[model samples]
Target: MTMQDSTDLPRDTSRVDSLEDKSLLLVDDDQPFLNRLGRAMERRGFEVRTASSVGEGLAEVRRAAPAFAVVDLRLEDGTGLDVVQALHGAREDARAVMLTGYGNITTAVAAVKLGAVDYLAKPADADDVEAALLARPDALPEPPENPMSADRVRWEHIQRVYELCGRNVSETARRLNMHRRTLQRILAKRSPR
Candidate 1:
């Protein structure tokens, strides 16, 4: 991997030719994460389809089954399991991974049983997802080269809660047991490292 500018960007490369029909579906209610991951998947040679909710995901599945999928565990309209079930129904070979910030054994088992080949926690990058989607039982998840620091973890948790509260500072503060002013100050700053 050669540096392309200071960012250490990799050269555009693919294991398969561009003509390979590698359709992938991604469903997550978080718009920013969804878009970023979708673009990353595209760069990795996938024909990406994105949706933000179960209904939208299912609709896309009906339109065409994807060979690979990444689904969020929670969505505004319904659970990601719904999307996984729909995909499994439409395509026997669909390789799907379920992602969640709140992971538990029950849900993990349920997700795998429902059709997801793998389950990942939130903050999983594109590579982790791609590996899961293209599952090889012998392969293992590569640890993040740049793991989030404590401050970054706090910032991300607050942001997730705030988004859950519809971005209402007071509501988020109340839920997190933080002063409104402090929460606002934190939100106003550039996220911590």
Candidate 2:
């Protein structure tokens, strides 16, 4: 069983609607992540609406532009930069922050060129995201306080490759040049610190 085993609970939107300049759009392919982050942002005074794909995110933006956005760089269907561009087209003043488990220099630069205000590596908290989204354009956001453990970086890289290979263990092993059983063991274990 998972945290999302029950999806019948209703989300309360009344209090969310009453807050102005606090509307947010959160886009990620991971449903549990979107749900958890949505609630967290709401706790910090944001009226949160979430989407799990670039198409859905674009649709949501067309329906209603948000004051802020936290977008996952890689969606199941397409890149989150598409959503950022759409949001900027709808409302140029909207602030957007990009998140990725596979953060790279090229993608970060592309995201910025597409109008995202900031790029963040994943496992980021709502506070970090909020700060980036709300920070002044001229100011540089503070660097990450803690360095990622080498094992954690390896775990994140493996996960990213696994996802890219459509979760196929054999394909991921081939790409990573590891034996199939070794890849399986890594995938089954909890993420390293």
Candidate 3:
């Protein structure tokens, strides 16, 4: 089509709208993940702000409630749900998403009740976050392009428990109901690809 015809043909100007107020708050205790996600979101047209703890996230919310948020379930100081709640309290129109490495039914339900638009497991990519933030109320999100493999999920679970138990092999093994030696062996191996 000619340039003038192309201009007349309806153009998707979603990215152009990024110049508008698309402030986003991201809270996670994981330093690397937080930084990476922040940069990715910025590239996707969001004015990204980040915090590493519940306290920081609350402070950011108090300063100004963002249009969107992605918060971790557990923080060093408190639960990320606190941030989500505060954001909703500040701005009723804010859309929030909860993130967790340790996902469970109760917490997911709680996130929804607290006004979160969606709940996502840890290791979620930038695309997933963007889709959730901008999704229409009546639309369902598309599935992830690359979901975690079963082995990877198992590995992540073991790793989370191991960290939660303060890296005490015996305790993690006991909690997981696996033999200490087996737990040790799994820990020793590299995470599945």
Highest TM-score among the candidates is held by which one?
Answer: 3
Clashes of each: 0, 0, 0
What clash pairs does model 3 have? none
Q: Candidate 3, after superposition: displacement of residue 158 in Å? A: 18
Per-residue CA lDDT of candidate 1, range 1-193, in tens?
9546855765433222333558999999999999999999999889999999999999999999998899999999989999999999999888899999875445777898988888898899998887677655445545766776888878878887897799999999999999999999999998765
Model 3 scores what on Cα lDDT? 0.87
TM-score of 3: 0.67
Cα lDDT over the full model 1: 0.86
**What lDDT tens digits, residue by residue, belong to model 3 across residues 14-83?**
3223435799999999999999999999898889899999999999999989999999999999999899
Give the range of the ten consecutive residues with the poorest summed lDDT in model 2.
11-20
Clashes of 3: 0
**How well does candidate 2 match the true structure in TM-score terms?**
0.66
lDDT score for residue 69 of model 3:
96
Residues 1-193, candidate 2, lDDT per residue (tens digit)?
A: 6576455778542222332587899999888888999998889888899999999999999999999899999988989999999999999989899999976655787788888988899889987887787676666556668866898888878887887798899999999999999999998998776
